[model samples]
Target: MSLTKEAIQLITDTALVATAKALDTDMPTVVIPEGAKVVNLEAYGAFRSRFRGTFSTNSLLDFGKYVTDRAVGDARGFINQDEMTCSVLFNLGTEEAPGHADDRAVLKLKATAGYQAVQAISGRAMSQKDMSDWIEDWNSTLSAVGEDNQNISLVKAIAAVRTITVKASSESDHTVSETRASRSAMDAIEATSKETLPTSLIFSVVPFEGLQLREIILRISVITSGAQPALKLRWVGEEVQREEIAQEFKSVLQDQIGDAAALSLGAFDPK
Candidate 1:
């Protein structure tokens, strides 16, 4: 996060104010003759101005940013993950495709698993990349935090997700990639037949190569009655700006190329 010039000034000013308090408490009282100019609390504007100028020019930009972020983080408070409890499940599976003549298209169904573990950490240390990754799986993680209803904080929500084998029916049954999302996440997707709850606030960005992903929260409810789970494309956005994101997802899903992948999209209901 970029710190504004005003925020930097406030930081310097606050520090200067604290310094003045410490000095007044520890230093001996000074009596200056009339017209004498000794810097004191009365000259706070000047003192703060000079301090801010020096701080702004110094190469402590990183330090300044860290301090500013710390201030903001403290204001946001911390999340106690241990007191929090949640249900968890996530998985990935695939099937074969026989229609395509291309050898690379021999497989019809494919799913790649993500292996990134979720855990709460210092939000002050969170960067843009961190936000992107967290929001990508926010709903699944939230499902893990389901029904806790105890005013979940951002950092806690970010870190609350952990895959539990306790509820997964297909744990380790499908490990297409070296990395895969926790079983809890997969269970979340299957249990609700939706990517996330409607109330979930997800954050995502657009890709230059394809459609802009406006719905930070995405969904792929499946037609559960089928022998194999097929995605419900129309419900991807669940009616939020579906006109834009729905078309974009459909176009991209069609243009995508890979192994053991199915590009099936149609009207289907959950069994």
Candidate 2:
């Protein structure tokens, strides 16, 4: 039988009430002091211990360059120098939000040999008068220009390769730069030179406005998967960083909410 308008309204109201009751039963019950005036009961225990922060696409790239620029003793034009440009990888989805609204940007600082090269060359920018004669002599010996991208040992190993591959059923002949023996040699060189250059950089990162994480170190490691190798910078000491974030949040809360009550970092359990 078709229900009347009043009957349908009654059924809808009953369902809404039942859902509210279920939610209340499942939610944790926050105890209130006796004779306390309760206000906004739904929002009483809404304090969140963990928070998410994101950086804008351009901000991420700039931050990456800033870190490198600082590391190489603030070398002039180091960030944009053709061979020494900071390799910051990131992407903004097709649907980009205007201004700094794009939050999915995660900057990956690809630690390349050029960073070391820049460090090696930055000394040349200073005048000889600014250095002691002995220091200058030592600096001259270390002034040899380093390869922009390739490691010196790896380049030497590949240059020493003598083996060649002869294809029997190939349309065009191709020359193999590094044979298996050379690869083995390169691997040995890489094992020692993997961390020859600075692997991690200590700097500040402002993931959110007015919130700068100072002395946050990001460590990079090389990954050899396919024909081309890649570098990845991963954040370490996450617990410490999180603690700093929590403290910042706690301070802000105390400033506005007053220090009458003690604030702690934790979560609530739903019954």
Q: Note the Cα lDDT for every prediction shown.
A: 0.30, 0.34
> What's the count of clashing pairs in each model shown?
19, 0
How many backbone clashes are present in model 1? 19
Q: Which stretches of candidate 1 lie over 4 Å from their true place?
A: 1-151, 163-201, 204-213, 219-235, 238-242, 245-271
Question: How many steric clashes does model 2 contain?
Answer: 0
Which tens-of-lDDT digit does each residue in 183-208 have in candidate 2?
A: 22212213123223333433333434
Give candidate 1's error at residue 106 in angstroms: 35
lDDT of 2 at 96: 50
RMSD of 2: 21.2
The alpha-carbon deviation from the true structure for residue 241 of candidate 2, after best TM-score superposition, in angstroms, is: 1.1
Best by TM-score: 2
